[model samples]
Target chain A: GAGVSQSPRYKVAKRGQDVALRCDPISGHVSLFWYQQALGQGPEFLTYFQNEAQLDKSGLPSDRFFAERPEGSVSTLKIQRTQQEDSAVYLCASSLRTRVEQFFGPGTRLTVL
Target chain B: GESVGLHLPTLSVQEGDNSIINCAYSNSASDYFIWYKQESGKGPQFIIDIRSNMDKRQGQRVTVLLNKTVKHLSLQIAATQPGDSAVYFCAEKSPGGGATNKLIFGTGTLLAVQP
Candidate 1:
């Protein structure tokens, strides 16, 4: 597949539980971004990574949210002590360069019960 | 607290008719803009893009018009089809976000193409 991939496609976790979502970006992509999309709203930026460097995370909603791309090819977003408010579709996008067009993944729908 | 936003929340059009979606941005420094379409259960797919320097750009059956003076942007779809039913969003790249070119997305407009 030439496009970005994410898993698991759907996740349901109890409140206060911790969950981790993974994103596999397009090969050789230099920039990867994470976004959160609530129902009826456009995706909101959460964080960004340039290879292994986390250049910005200004959009992260809370300290409980964490993301890492240790190898720079694959990234993971972890939410600790999840709350109902954390439920949303988590989207991942990749671009060949910074500030250019990006390709997005199908996104992982996370449901906090 | 500048942000991108859309004028309409939903738009319905008959097949073969044209469709238009509009957006507004508060940041004048945004140098790039893009439009994305998201079908049910799918991620947003890029439709078209226009640089701040240009007023209009066209793709397949889509056209993007930029009004820098008013900070407004619009996407026009020709001969709307059933496949065109989706939520459309407009995004602007923030100039101050360094090389990352962080994109700020607007509230999307749901386009419903009816037969």
Candidate 2:
């Protein structure tokens, strides 16, 4: 079975630009999560979605960060007015409705200059 | 301020030898703990997980031990291989129920397997 998949394995953007990262969770996964990882550090939770409903967005660092998971399958993390501080790997994970173990994607590395 | 942290930044071990990584968590209310393996340029891969109700759990070549009394966690790998060389992290679920809770991750421990 295919695990979670994220597009644009690598991205380079100028400061103040807008970037969108996409994630395709497993076929029937009901839970999806996004995380940001800085260099030499572990991933930090960004947001979570259960099906098509956004359950948690408290981890989002700033108002420029936004996410949505419509249709209960695909999810997107969009960062408006990108900043150098936002240069990090964005990871996506999904899990079964009954399990706490999450399956992660390869992640999209965004470098803001 | 709840957090999970690793005892060592890096660990070097010989191939075929057993390796153990340690973690310390601040939240005593944490009910679930998980071990993840991440390779360069890749996201975290789940290795194993243990709930607070149990003290230990094992997977194919990995074992996770949890100690609620000391708020400690450990991951033991049997017969380490070169492929096991990667960053290992310990994550804990926030104190609550439901599978949708966010995870608090440790800084990570780099496992270097020397053949």
lDDT by residue for model 1 (B1-115), tens: 7699999999999999999999999988888999999999999999999998899999999999999999999999999999999999999887777877678899899999999
* Candidate chain B TM-scores, in order: 0.97, 0.95
In Å, residue A86's CA in model 2 sits off its true spot by: 0.2
> What are the Cα lDDT values of the candidates?
0.94, 0.94
- Give TM per candidate: 0.98, 0.97
The ten-residue window of minimal lDDT in model 1 chain B covers B93-102
Write candidate 2's Cα lDDT for B20-108 as tens digits: 99999998899999999999989999999999999999999999999999999999999999999999999998775344678889999
Off by over 4 Å in 1: none
Q: How far is candidate 1 from the true structure (C-alpha RMSD, Å)?
A: 0.9
Q: How close is candidate 2 to the true structure, as a TM-score?
A: 0.97
> How far is each candidate from the true structure, as Cα RMSD in Å?
0.9, 1.1
Q: What is the DockQ of each candidate?
A: 0.84, 0.85
Interface RMSD of 2: 0.8
Kindly report which residue pairs in candidate 1 clash with one another: none
